[model samples]
Target: MKRLLTAALLTLSIAAPNAFAGDTRLELPLQDLIDSPQAKEAGIDGSVRFYLSGQAHPAVVSRMGEDVSNKKTNGVGKSDVESCRWVALSVLKAFQESAKARGANAVVDITSYFKKNEFKSPTNYECYAGNIMSGVALKGTYAKVK
Candidate 1:
């Protein structure tokens, strides 16, 4: 009887996992994520600046190109906001690395590109937190700035 009950509960949970943990749509501050501890640990610095969509940035001496980072997010024991911040930081680090690889010093015109849907915001970026796996998708252009 105990085994049967456990099995049934498991099936129900698998069928409707969102009922237990709903997806959260968050528009968190772009600067806050960039200033997070994870970003600091990743060595993200002024060496490679990130300018959000619609934000005024230094003139691009050379436009390296644009790219996207759909970084993975593991909730673990942290809340949606916490997980989102970490994921966003990871995405930023990825972009910074790419900028370095491409001989660029800045990642500008950053946007939330979840599912390829561009969500432009000068101050905030979009993150989706889910029961299975949260994520932050960022699209940005790499450039050498003035």
Candidate 2:
């Protein structure tokens, strides 16, 4: 009887936390800052979408000049590389936060993009900036299986 009681208690302890595992949704950018205790208990998985925008000072263009000879002088190319990193990082953070909210342990199928035909010329000078928009979507079930 004691052994049976002990086994029942252990089972309850293990199963209690997983009882609440379910589909979750969230929107935030705090993944790196916090840890989700429920992730393991709830059996979580997730995915993220991201976007970024960037601008380059006139100095960038001036430095390159009209030197068609320079393969790297492409105005748009320079701005995208310079600013996309921060944008991607921010998007990643948002995805993490979403996963935590949804009780997801991790994210998959992550995708990113820059707004097409979304370039604008500086009104005053030759400065240019690129705009990027991103989104994160989570899909999966939460459960602790053996």
Candidate 3:
């Protein structure tokens, strides 16, 4: 009986090696700051759409939503690099929310204001200022296009 049980277990393991593997979670960095061309081609909704340009559509009804900015003070022992990164993320988040509130699908013409020219990305309009405080600013344009 013991030999039979062992044989059965080994057979199952050999036949289905991945049977014990459940859904695994993997952490990965994502860059979704700009809307993909596929989204534009599919006529994606504005609520879930974001753009790095001033006008989402040239032939659609569009308006300047507003200018939004955010600032964060540096914490103790935090280097300027880290501080600017934190502030830029915070400000961009605020800008996105502000644009959504005003019915803007995307924020365009983004310019970064950073000390000593910090990290650069294809997306975002950032402003880094102040020794104690870092800041970012952006202008959003609300558009409704079919």
RMSD of each: 3.0, 22.4, 17.4
When summed lDDT is taken over every stretch of 10 residues in candidate 1, the lowest stretch is 15-24
lDDT of 3 at 84: 48
Residue 52 displacement in candidate 2 (angstroms): 17
lDDT by residue (tens digit), candidate 2, 42-108? 2323342111122221111111111000011122333442332233333345444554565444333
The better candidate by TM-score, 1 or 2, is 1
Higher-lDDT candidate of 1 and 3: 1
Please list all clashing residue pairs in model 2, or write none if there are none.
44-105, 49-135, 49-136, 50-134, 51-133, 51-134, 52-132
How well does each candidate superpose onto the true structure, as a TM-score? 0.85, 0.27, 0.45
Best by lDDT: 1
Model 1 lDDT per residue over 22-132, tens place: 378899998876776777886788689999989998998999889999987777688888888888888988998899999999999999998899999999999888775
Better of 1 and 3 by TM-score: 1
Candidate 1's TM-score reads: 0.85
How far does residue 140 in candidate 1 sit from its true spot (Å)? 0.8
Separate clash counts for every candidate:
0, 7, 3
Residue-level lDDT tens digits of model 3 in 17-134:
3432212211111123224343334333345334444323334456555464645545336554455455545555666567677776655544343332333334444444343444
**lDDT of candidate 1 at residue 85, scale 0 to 100:** 85
